[model samples]
Target: MPEATWTYLMDMDGVLVHEEHLIPGADELLAELTGTGTPFLVLTNNSIYTPRDLRARLLRTGLDVPEESIWTSALATAKFLDDQRPGGSAFVIGEAGLTTALHEVGYILTDRDPDYVVLGETRTYSFTSITRAIRLIEQGARFIATNPDATGPSREGSLPATGSVAALIQQASGHAPYFVGKPNPLMMRSALNRLGAHSETTLMIGDRMDTDVRSGLEAGLKTILVMTGISAADTAEHFPYRPSRVIDSVAALVGSTDKPFG
Candidate 1:
């Protein structure tokens, strides 16, 4: 495999792996990138796990990814709040994963007089929890969402994802949240900062247009959409926004980026 023209930002779930299994050829693609110092990170919208946890998961899958390569919406959410709100208190309508990450970053998470409301894909979401979130937002509390992915398919089938919860919060609060996952510049900026590269020199590869392509485009990086998870051949034409390059899978970018863009 030859070195790519620019640094690559890789998406997890779809572009690399599927649940607890690695997608076919993912290891070879990732290994080629690492050997060439392609400068890629596992950008994931799933915030259920921390970066440390993600690192371990990848290792278990036989992909020796470093901790720094795993960047989740959980970390991005904390960074966004810390920058925008600056020591502000938040009422998290999310699971322990979100609140724990927020607390680790020195943000105050409290139920009383919270300046903002944070929402994510929480299995614990109930009427009482949602009602409290709406009440906070109604009282001038700002709203923040981790990701906006509507459905994530697993071995079981398609299931409600982070985007569903984000939609619910927006509908009830009558105010859309500032997203922090892929497609939202925050995730790209964080990865770029860590990789020490500019958008002109970076290439983001993933399977989702709304998230990966949008995020890369917003960050001024070249986008490559792979057809492994969400986006497919039929849906490509429907997206108002398109990636710079669309490949069948990450394997295309591995040995050679020689294929023509469709």
Candidate 2:
């Protein structure tokens, strides 16, 4: 094997783009990874869109990410649920992405006392659905959430996301959900398994220390914290664990040199 044989698991929102805008050098970095025949996947905690849907969105931002190269918490949640109980059913509170993933995994979507109450990100969460979820959980269905992100960035402002909704349901049902997204090493491990990569030679890049960095560290991958998104330079210092490197953006990782990182 090569001396620096490395694969990558990069966060999507902050590391590569912000909202609909591609961060500077993101394209170049992607090109470098593609050209080097490096195996990598763009990981996102957002379960709002499927990989095919997200690929189109990235294309609009001038990034050509293949659908197969994208991994979402929706996919991870489906895999997790499948591993736990194959061909089971769930009462889903999400959009097309989450529902599609579960369907692909042969999971039944229903509201009739299902195996799990799967919560995920949506443009607008309904109060009625949340009430139903609380009732289901109280009636003995296990609670599962796609991610723990309380709020999501939007054009207007931050909007309540899956975690926020999960909290409300938990408040009513008196049971915390098992969050399957970032900060949970299970998601990272699943991504690594998808890539057939070992943590010893993998890198995790993201902007958030709480989620990205924490998850990567727990997964035993070298972590890089960029400042283009949520976590700032000073914010890293407050975390109990530090990233392997702190850079301004993915731009610092664009070059093809085998010097670990540019």
TM-score of each: 0.88, 0.97
**What digit string (tens of lDDT, one per residue) describes model 2 on residues 1-262?**
6586689899999888898899999999898888888999999998989999999999999999999999999999999999999999999999899999999999999999799999999887888999999999999999999999999887899899888888888888999999999999999999999999999989899999999999999999999999999987798989789999998888888775245455
Which residue pairs show collisions in model 2? none
Clash number for candidate 1: 1
Alpha carbon deviation, residue 90, candidate 1 (Å) = 1.1
Clashes of each: 1, 0
User: Each candidate's lDDT (Cα)?
Assistant: 0.80, 0.92
| Model 1 alpha-carbon drift over 4 Å, by segment | 1-5, 256-262
Model 1 Cα lDDT, one tens digit per residue, 75-151: 78888888786778998877656887799878898878898888877655688888898888888988888988787
Q: What TM-score would you give candidate 2 relative to the actual structure?
A: 0.97
Residue 152 error, candidate 2, Å: 0.6
Span of ten consecutive residues with least summed lDDT in model 1: 253-262
